[model samples]
Target: MLIDVAIEKVKGLISFFEGYRETGFLEALQIAKEIALEMNIDATFRKRRKIKRKKQFDENPDDTNIAPQSAQESFRVNYFIRVVDQAISSLTRRFEQYEGYQKIFGFLFTSETLRSLDKDSLKSSCVNLEASLTKDKQSDIDANELFVELKSLQNFMPKENIGPVEILNFLKRHDCFPNASIAYRVLLTIPVTVALAERSFSKLKLLKSYMRTTMTQQRLNDLATIALESEVLEKIDYEDIIEDFISKNTARMRMFK
Candidate 1:
């Protein structure tokens, strides 16, 4: 059910995180909760099981290591919840801190460096450091709009954080070509999260569509390779290579001369 819910809400979930980095933890947890709900995993079930186990332990406290087992289980459950909650909280705080620093200084640092400095760095750096990092000083362009656009990016994504087109449009809205260009530059670095590449490869697996029956695994691999490398096959006698293999195997009854 959670997977179904996730599938249905995938678009919305992505959009939220796209605009706001802080939404990452929340989205991850939401997805996890949705999955757990779908799988019918509940606190009630865990609690009931815990109670039953506790009774068994109470009846034979001397014989079994029930205390340690219970402690470990409780620790595991609490650890899971804490880890999820901490991640969400950290994301929110980190994004805000980054935004604050950028607003005052104009540059976003790498996480390592960002973690080192305090508010002192903000005063020392220019107000447009982040926006100007991507700009040519000779251009003498207004940097305010770029900062405005950056700040407007929120944690709540409408659906699918943002698409290429929407991000392009967001850049256009700010009229900060330098920042927009940089955004696109960063965008290209991210691999497409969609499974289009995998699906295309899957099509290669079905290359034996010409045959009706199930193909032998080896034959399937050969067919897939041939189909994928069809252009290269045009320049080589691939069939002859396989025929040679058959000849080598079939005509191998040699006697000592």
Candidate 2:
């Protein structure tokens, strides 16, 4: 995913939540009233028992006629505004990592972005990438080697109608550009969301049931893989598999043929 684009989306959501916080009270009240109307009931807050306490040492005891909050005011202050504030705060906190992600991987976002970089900028990007990935004196790729390889790679790749996916495919076929391959592999394998991981966990609940108590770990893993990857399994040619299964010997091959 494009880091800048993702960051913009997160910002947009926060802005929307802020706008809601400012002007959403009356609208929320209206919706509550409408729901109450549909149910043939009054939209009202339950009255609390009035309590009296000693005034503060500096306070006037004569001032005791505090107006109780109306249901609209109570709900607005207690629920609507608080919920919207939480939404804004949570959004800001959750997506803050996107900015750091952009800094590390922004230059490799697209084919056009990569191709447009001048040599000096590209070299700087490689150096920065090396720094980000370096740990305990080990590095994924040599920055200078990656710089030279990418410069040579740009000359032969198509100017349009391509992105990192296509570039990775090229690397796969030729097995050249080791540094570029590592970089692109890391770039492409970044998890955009946790939905797939969540789904795998969900699948485990269904796959390892009471009846499957005795299943071996390896067999369970294989079953989970096949069950989760049913889309890929659907596209496989069953006839080819059947033929291959049958042709295990000369007699079997002759019979199948």
**Which model scores highest in TM-score?**
2
lDDT of 1 by residue, 1-257 (tens): 11222223544544454444433444555677688899988623233344443446347556655353454346435764566456556555544544453353323222223233454453243234444445554423234544343444322123343444455555566654565345444434333333645754776647656663677879877877777667798999777876666666645424211
TM-score of 2: 0.79
Distance (Å) between predicted and true CA of 140, model 2?
A: 3.4
Q: lDDT at 80 for candidate 2?
A: 86
For model 1, the superposed segments whose C-alpha errors exceed 4 Å read: 1-73, 76-78, 97-257
lDDT of candidate 1 at residue 39, scale 0 to 100? 95
lDDT to native, each model: 0.47, 0.83
Worst 10 residues of 2 by lDDT: 59-68
C-alpha RMSD (angstroms) for model 2: 3.4
What is candidate 2's lDDT per residue for 1-257, written digit by digit as tens?
54556688888999988998988777877898899999999787777777678678887656666677876688778988889999888888757777777777777776677788899999999999999889999999999999998888777677784767888898788777999999989877776667878999999999999998999999999999999999999999999998888877788888867
Residue 96 displacement in candidate 1 (angstroms): 3.4
lDDT value, candidate 1, whole model: 0.47
TM-score of each: 0.22, 0.79
